[model samples]
Target: MADRFHEGLRSQVAFVTHTRDYRSAEVLPSLARHGFTTTERPHDRETERLLAQFDPDLVVLAIDPRHDDDIALVRQVARACKAQIIVVAPGPHPHGLALALEAGADVCVRDTDGGEMFNAQLGAILRRKTSPIEQEAEDDGPSTITVRDLVLDFDRCQAVRNGESIPLTPTEFKILAYLAKNAGKVVSPVEILRAVQDYTYSEREAQEIVKVYIRRIRRKVELDPAEPSYIVNVRGFGYMLERRSNRRDAVRASEAA
Candidate 1:
């Protein structure tokens, strides 16, 4: 099992759901099989309080079709908690999943998926989360990529905006690297889906999936996300990142200074 496969995460897990008994009966046992100390919480105002007390390594939150919060609850959970989030969407609500993703949850899984599936997927996600840090430990190669005032240091696994750190999720970092590497050209979502996600998505799915990521990325990199200077959206096509700095400009600025 992936839980055993990745021993670090077998310690603690918390699940918040309206259908607690139905889901937790299956989920808690699966977690126990992999040696997780699990907690169950109601999908109510007390969710954050319960989670804070548990302080789990991972948090699994379910969005029931019955009650919906105006993205506020999710934003609060994401901001208040230090754990990685996995939002469980009602089987029928893809938009809810999209909203959760936009709110900065690490991932979303459908209600139909079993707990074991979540365990495997979460393990892979956690592994990816740690990879940049691992790479940072032995970054004898090039450590920094500079684009104007925005600098990404692979050695430190961080992005700085005019010396201020701009935090990025792992997916955001990978997508930025791909776009920066292919700067000055329209990169279709199909390309990003295949490159970043390792699978091809239908154009509609690709756009929907990639747009949420783009929105998040823009907020981090663009001076004004409402009117972006760096990442230009081609109306019917994909996206193009205008090169933020020229090497010659850098040389000239250095000489003048």
Candidate 2:
């Protein structure tokens, strides 16, 4: 495919993968047409140095989720650069995509996606970086929200409980934040999924996917994962993050029991 040169883009891209030959020919040329300068590195110790030198506007990591260290690599890259990231997982592991996003990638795309689709993802990232609306939203909102003893810092993608930091993946944090933002209301799994992932799914599928992440969040935030007080499941409905008043009532009920 011919590279389409979009003027004024000039974004520098850094691509990192386990091997030098995994779709570089396709990815580099596709990005080039978008007026992005490209650099490639193998996923190794040297990659961080290359990233430091390249100073890219975006970083693309090609990874398989099965490798235990892949998530670590994502964290390493995230710590190494402030660049927006795109993760290309080469197969049908939706869970892997979740983990990649949780680790800090701005977006995750499948290897099977066509060049145009890939470029579109890049364009979206660029737009988000420069969009006036996004800037305005960032400027206008309170960057943190407090829920019970937990404090969520939106600017940092971090959560704290009782003066200690609670470790949460980006997706997990997003789910928790969404729930906190709508505390006391029952939220359907589809609503949680759309709020966190910005994608729609069948209700059943959304339930299963959201269930797993909610369970994971509970383990991190709840005093008892088995009997979650903050994230309460509404039978036949969905889940709710208990409001402070509800939490006190639950506490009183527990004390009486």
Task: Count clashes in each candidate, considering only residues at least 3 apart in sequence or on different chains.
Answer: 0, 0
TM-score for model 2? 0.60
Q: What is the total number of backbone clashes in candidate 2?
A: 0
Each candidate's lDDT (Cα)? 0.65, 0.70
lDDT of 2 at 137: 54
Shift in Å, residue 250, candidate 1: 25
Please, what are the lDDT tens digits per residue for candidate 2 over residues 1-257? 01322434665555555532366665777677666777766777788888888877778887875565887788788888877677777755667766765566666766776566577776655543333334445564577888788888877778998998987755677789898888778789889877665556567656656766777788898887876788887756788888663465534343110
Lowest summed lDDT across 10 adjacent residues in model 2 is found at: 248-257
Instruction: Give the local distance difference test score of model 2.
Output: 0.70
Question: Where in model 1 is the C-alpha error above 4 Å?
Answer: 1-5, 12-36, 65-67, 112-120, 131-133, 136-141, 193-201, 244-257
Write model 1 residue lDDT over 152-253, tens digit each, in one string: 776566778888998887667777877766777778888975775444556876677678888898988877787666666766677766675432332222
Q: Pick the candidate with the highest TM-score.
A: 1
Clashing pairs in 1: none
List candidate 2 stretches off by more than 4 Å. Answer: 1-13, 18-26, 29-37, 52-57, 67-72, 75-84, 95-106, 116-144, 151-173, 188-190, 201-228, 232-239, 245-257
Q: What TM-score do all the candidates reach, one by one?
A: 0.73, 0.60
